[model samples]
Target: MKAMIFAAGLGTRLKPLTDTMPKALIRVGGKPLLQHVIEKLKGSGFDEIIINIHHFADQIIDFVESNDYFDIRIEFSDERDRLLDTGGGVKKASWFFDDHKPFLIHNVDILSNIDLRSLYKIHELNNSEATLVVSDRPTSRYLLFDDSLQLKGWLNKTNGETKSHFPDINPDNYNKLAFSGIHILNTSILSYMQHFPDKFSIIDFYLSICSKVRVAGYTPVNLKMIDVGKPGSPEEAESLLL
Candidate 1:
């Protein structure tokens, strides 16, 4: 299986740590966050991987080279010229997923106990264009899903704003789930994304076409996860991951 790790972001939240190193290189659980993700994915049956790099691009490259890429088939998507957000990063790395199978996309900073194999099996069985991993955790923003777990829209609790592809249905009619920064996407949906901007969130792009396509959400029960991007996350990660 193939997967892409989004590691190009200039993680402003980590401040001085990020000022000296890319977020991908931030040590967590006695290793870089990217290393944790790579080991996890490799153990989860992913054989090929591509990681995007921008902030401290060379450092990430050097780190991967230093470790011999953990003995997996690893590739780097250089984003040193311009930083592309989630959607754009996926679009730019489309060539890596050319095998036509559904591939996984994950965040470098996300440390999770998500079962990648189970998620992939669910995507295959559901036969959806994409399956977003979600949870019932408390979050200010959420993705709206219908009774059948189909993507319907998005809502921001902090600002009381809503965006939906299906205008006829009330936003309140859908169940809200917090996105887990992980998803499996079939390459068949790539054709519709050519018109997207060079930099855009996948959430925005998903909502733009959900009405015409099958975008489902999967919320695993009792998901243990965290976004390891803040300044104190390393310490927190040591406690949780170690």
Candidate 2:
């Protein structure tokens, strides 16, 4: 199996620490955040991995090299010239997923106990073009899903803004789920990016295509996750570490 780690973010939320190092290199539970995700993916049967790097790119590359690429097939998707957003980062690494199989995309700063193998299996079983791991958690923004967990639209509770291709979409009519920053996407979805700009949020791309394709959500039972990019999340993430 193959996976892509989104580690190119500026991680502005982590301010001082980020000023000196990329969030992926920040130590949490005595290990860099990137290492935690890599080991988790490896444990879940992923053998090939592509990591996108921008901030402190050289540091990340050096770290990986020092570890001998973790004894697996690891490659770097160079984004040192420009930090592409999630969608663009994946698009930039499109060449790595040439096997035409579904690949897992994970955020480097997200620490979670969700079963990656189970998540990938669910995506294949549903035959969804993309399956986003989500949770019934409170957040300012949410992805709305129908009774069957098919993504319907996005809603920002803070401003009452919504985005959806469905003309009759009603935020109140669907289930609002917080995205877990982890998802399984089929390589076929890359075909939709030809018209997109150089940088764009993956959520935006999903919203624009959900009405035409099956973009579903998978909510793992007892999901525990922490966005370690936040100022104080690193400490909290320690509890989720095994």
lDDT score, candidate 1: 0.90
- Cα-based TM-score, every candidate: 0.97, 0.98
C-alpha lDDT (0 to 100) for residue 106 of candidate 1:
91
lDDT of each: 0.90, 0.93
Candidate 2 accuracy as lDDT: 0.93
Model 1 residue 217 lDDT score: 94
Q: Per-residue lDDT of 1-242 in model 2, one digit per residue for the tens?
A: 99999999898999989998999999998999999999999999999999999999999999999999999999999999987899999889999999999999999999888999888888899989999999999899999999999999999999999999999789999999999899999999999987899899999999999988999999999888999988889988887786
What CA RMSD would you report for each candidate? 1.1, 0.9
lDDT of 1 at 173: 87
Each model's backbone clash number: 0, 0
